[model samples]
Target: MLQIDRWKRILIIGLCVIGLAYAMPNLFYKRVEAHNDAVAAVEKAGGAATPEQEAAIALWPNWLPSSLVNLGLDLRGGAHLLAEVQVEQVYKARMDALWPELRRVLADQRSTIGAIRRVDAPDGQLRIEIENADQMSVAVQAARGLAVPVATLTGAGQDDLDVSAQGNTLTVQLSEAEKALTDDRTILQSLEIVRRRVDEVGTREPTIMRQGADRILIQVPGIGSAAELKALIGTTAQLTFNPVISTGSSADATPGIGEIILPSQEQPGLYYTLEATPVVTGEELTNAVPSTDQNGAPSVDFRFNPTGARKFGEYTSANVGQPFAIVLDNEVISAPVIRQAITTGSGQISGSMDYESANQLAVLLRAGALPAELTFLEERTIGPELGQDSIDAGRIAAAVGFVAVIFLMVASYGLFGVFASIALAVNMGLIFGILSAIGATLTLPGIAGIVLTIGMAVDANVLVFERIREELRTAKGPARAIDKGYQNAMSAIVDANITTLIIAAILFVLGSGPVKGFAVTLSIGIVTSVFTALWVTRLMTVTWFERRRPRTIEV
Candidate 1:
């Protein structure tokens, strides 16, 4: 009996030593530079972060935010938004792509229909009119090539059309029927546009994802104010370059219909003539860098690729000294006079702006273009106070649970129960060490996992004690009873824990965000509990028995 108890004691002590050693890495991990920098920065910002806190930050999960593990919005207070991308513009683009085909189809049957005039519907549909109902029927056959199957078909026949209009007011019913609402091309194009627009306001780590149908969900933490985001996203960035016309010229002439004129070859006038055709478009520039001009003034230096450079060089050579306007999203950012031919494919854009404005303009130009305009449907922000309150409540609950479990074990198993309590404490230390090693954030639910582990830690001891009682009643000697108890209890311990572990795994796989956090902590706690209970507690009990052999075991 003493021999078997000695062996169990040795085994438990060895595991404890190894566990402590395995956890040693977390001690040094507390000193990583990123952890130090974050702590120092927080202190410099007038935040009261103690050394103990700085150490805790290092142990947080790598996947979680660097800040403290906060409760979800349900536990803590936060804002929520349901943002959706406007897909009407997608329909508009589709209509534009089909416009050319429509024009060709109408022109091909112009003679048969006897002159046809088409009006564009606001919802991006075409309404065709001819001489009479007979002519309309003929034109409809020609337009069939350009017409797509209407998902939401309405109205009766040609006289009572699906799309109706009176005088100039037109109404077309839009629906999501059997028709394909959006295609892969339109979705990709929309995503790119949203990305560009969101980046324009210099948002930090915005999570933009495509949702069901035609919706996008954007999540930005630590960003409370969303008015600026709304402004940047809602506005359509439509850019156009029009030539500067002479004041003396016809005021009745349209913007782009003016005569193509250039500045004089060798004269500097207050108002030099300009060309109706743009010399170069902004799309040609591959990159824009914020730099200082030769005069030390803030300027944006833009560079073009091989194809764009050749076209830019040709345009500059043809229009030397001509004033060209630099337009951005329809607003003229600058109008630099072509003083000299820029054949090098590189040019500087100098606007009457300060350094901040120049930098922003350069950033926008570099970010590329958006295919469609984005509309902000929702915005949310959470205060740090709410997160702190959650932490406090969770701490209280965990502390109470810890004390209750410790007292329960000690009362239930007497001396062996006391050792179980110690093992329980060590088990918790190992869990934190493991959590710290793996960089897992400890949320409120994670605290619950730890508390539950404290209670579960005594499960093996209960099984061992009940087996020992059964063995003694069956006429086994002290040593034999102890060995048989441990052997018999192992299966039950494994079975119960394995079932719980499986449940935790399922919760982790199926849950999201906070639920997943709870599952992770629960899973880790289960493994830690089994180790401390089956091995650590058993070893301590065996060691005590070897030293002080009791006569008839007292339950």
Candidate 2:
């Protein structure tokens, strides 16, 4: 009477086998990691592997699961940085872009508004002085016409630009609501760019997320140091091609309104004055790759999208025999003369860069530039040796807890306790297996969760065993007692586990970093423990009782 269906038994056994199979790779973490990395490299290289890669790939069987639970920064030892984004830069850039259009609108009504010139203001404000003081209203109206509704939900129907007039001067600045919306977008964009930059290097499990209003927290495992990580992402890499006004050797040279002076990268102290508005910016770039120029020197080739191509083509066609400055982060990389029109939408940037620099530049370009510059608020580098020590400590803690639980279960429940111990072992395997399958990262707190789970995994078994003792005292046969014991304990096991699981889910949803890691392990452990207790241990007990036909059992 106390029997599992054949299909259910097969399912349970199949799951355990699969769990073991997946968990096996973690035992040889380095070998399996090498194998996985090599495989990925070969795939990325279009099925070509070097001798070293081939050997690494052969370290593990091809048919088995090679995925391992990722180690978090605390366990893998890497770089940690808290950076505050210079979000005001975006506001300044936005105001700069709006200037040309605003000037054009006022220029169209020159007869009424009179001559207008841009006046210097704060970083994010645009101010213009008009010749006709009586026409200040007209200038303000023209500037306000350029205003667009904010795109954010909370700022719906609000104008992005706040325009006002004092005397003959008109001022335009971003509204408070729009500033808030821009801040959010800027931070989100910065986060994504940082993530892309990190992912380009193929590091494992980097924790990159927003920390607060204008900050991002970056934790990258396997990177050499915080400085290395910062260097990889710190460069704004803002590339632009602007029409050059003139070349000079003065570092403090003044430029006309709407123009900027940038130092040349190749020739120190040499500068180039260029138009503020770029012919084409890096945002329109579709692809970039490391390449070689006609002289066989390292360079980067880039292609632009349709809009960018049209703008670039028109600019080059009109500016033949003139030079355009290729600027990166406000520094002139090159000021090359345009001999002929370039309409192919593709161009090359060649400078005093080697292949390594060219390749890094290409990677950065492909990943896109950060929306705003970041100021590092804090930085730290963790060593691999420390991570190993933490791993060792966690292993000892889990093993000690596991052994104690086994000893208590076996001593208290006799043969039934052995079944529980076996189930507990299976439960641990299943947790790791699920973690590997899901590609979750394991942190120090996650290890503590696993240790806690080792103690809790036996609770359901204890309840069932106690209920069996009660049933046996009522004079029920072994089979009937075992069946009633499981049935009576099922509700309590489900209730307790479900409540704990709800808490785990809440923690996972609301918590960050280590808390989420703990919740992840605990949640996985709860499910596996429940399954092993109600089904796995019961199956073992029913099989033993059937084989032995025990007339009576002792608790």
Candidate 3:
């Protein structure tokens, strides 16, 4: 241990230098953050950033280590929302979507099954009464043909649709396995939409994640309020293209089956009678952007995917001169007359929107529709003042803890204790350095974890030092004693730190929010502390001893 290998010494010094270099940016946190934001803005603006943003970017040099640890919501202050996704809404949509395909399939065999009429059923259930009652078995068989096998691990070979025949009617609904799949998809889609909307607002480090089976947890750091966040993500943005039957002042004008009346969003009191099934939905949209029409008015230009383009083109070519409604959330936003078939797969929507609303609609369309509406179950806004208070308190506690630990170590072990103290400081620098590199969020509980780390960093040093004292009684030279001490205490040091690390890993896996924050800091600190205590202090001690050639050392 006294005569260390050349590569091991280089590794120890290299790690220490890297740690301090990465930790240097945190000393000027605000300046570094401003620089990062400016760089991001410049990149987003196609390299044409404002003069002020350019000046901000110049505050920090590009060649240096620029990474900083991410601050958690409690540290930076922002909005938090707990939302439950209404998965049942997707069920109703699925049933509505299923009707069109079911109709087309059964209509192919109209001679055999006669006529098929939709009957009233529950929200997710589809019931069809066969005009020829004796041919109900044929209708059921045809509906069952629509059932496709699910591809999920647990849902393998499970039918997507459950079709049953009862008397003269056939019932069709999603199977239990299919509902589970739908719920999973709905929650995941909701999480992605919330993330996209929050990211579009340019907020820093937003945590948009799925909470439970059908819920989402959104925490945006450095945002204004929960209401602002809600405004960003609340819109369902369910845009649909429906075939219009007729337009009238009264909603009761169209009494055809599978037809309903909806009030126009643009023109109040005017209603449109549209088919229950839409020609195409927003799900088919590949891209949407805010652009100007030929008249230079703000409009949303959209492009459809191949499948949607084919469907829309077919509908348009067959129904030229007929009006179709661009419905948004069950309200007719626009009823335009189809002049020519748009085989190009791109179209523009001109409406009563200003630039801002048009831009918002473009963003919503680009982000795609939420699978289900999110009902806000809980909301809260964290103020920046409170975050500052937390910072101040944590600063004081960490400083006091560091100073107290340093004093106690120096008083007990003299020069050897001072070596341990230096290792302790290096341990902290490395922890923050790792956190910054990984972009881990530091919460209030994380600060506590740091303080806890400060206290525990000396455990290995204490064990080794005591062992040195025991070895000094048996060994002839102080150098021999020191080498024996490290080897003897190695098992105990590894056991204690590894056990703590196991607990930290468990917390990280099973915990959420603040608990996760604690786990992250604790886990980082353990690895750094062990490295600093063993290699760092040992390196410092052996170098001093070799340089001075101390025959009898106090340590």
Per-candidate TM vs. native?
Answer: 0.59, 0.99, 0.96
After superposition, which runs of candidate 1 have C-alpha atoms over 4 Å from their true positions?
Answer: 1-81, 97-119, 124-219, 223-378, 426-472, 475-512, 535-555
lDDT of model number 1: 0.60
Clashes of 1: 5
The candidate with the higher lDDT, 1 or 3, is: 3
Model 1 residue pairs with clashes = 1-479, 60-439, 61-439, 61-440, 61-441
lDDT of 3 at 80: 94
Better of 1 and 2 by lDDT: 2
lDDT of 1 by residue, 1-555 (tens): 434455666776776665565455444443443464556567665987777766655654444323222234433443334455565665554554445565577677767656645554466454555544455555555555444454333421222123344443323333243114353345565566656756655443354557677666654443444554554444453332334544223333343222333322122232323443354555566778789988898988888777777877776677677656555554455566677767788877775667986776666566554545555576766565776687677768877877887788778767767877888778876776666556565656777777777677778778887887788888567777877888889999999999999998998887654566678778887888888877777666667777778765654
The lowest-lDDT stretch of 10 consecutive residues in candidate 1 is 152-161
lDDT of 2 by residue, 1-555 (tens): 699999999999999999989998999999999999999999999998999999999999999999899999889999999999999999899998888899899999899988999988899998999999898988888888888899888898899999998888889999999999989989988888999999999999999989878889999988999999999999989999999988899978778878898999999989898889888999999999999999999999999999999999998999899988999988999998999999999999999999999999998999998889999999999999988899999999999999999999999999999999999999999999999999999999999999989999999999999999999988568888899999999999999999999999999999988999999999999999999999999999989987999888887
Candidate 2 overall lDDT versus native = 0.93
Candidate 2's displacement at residue 199, Å, is 0.5
Q: State the C-alpha lDDT per candidate.
A: 0.60, 0.93, 0.91
- Model 2: weakest 10-residue lDDT segment is 251-260
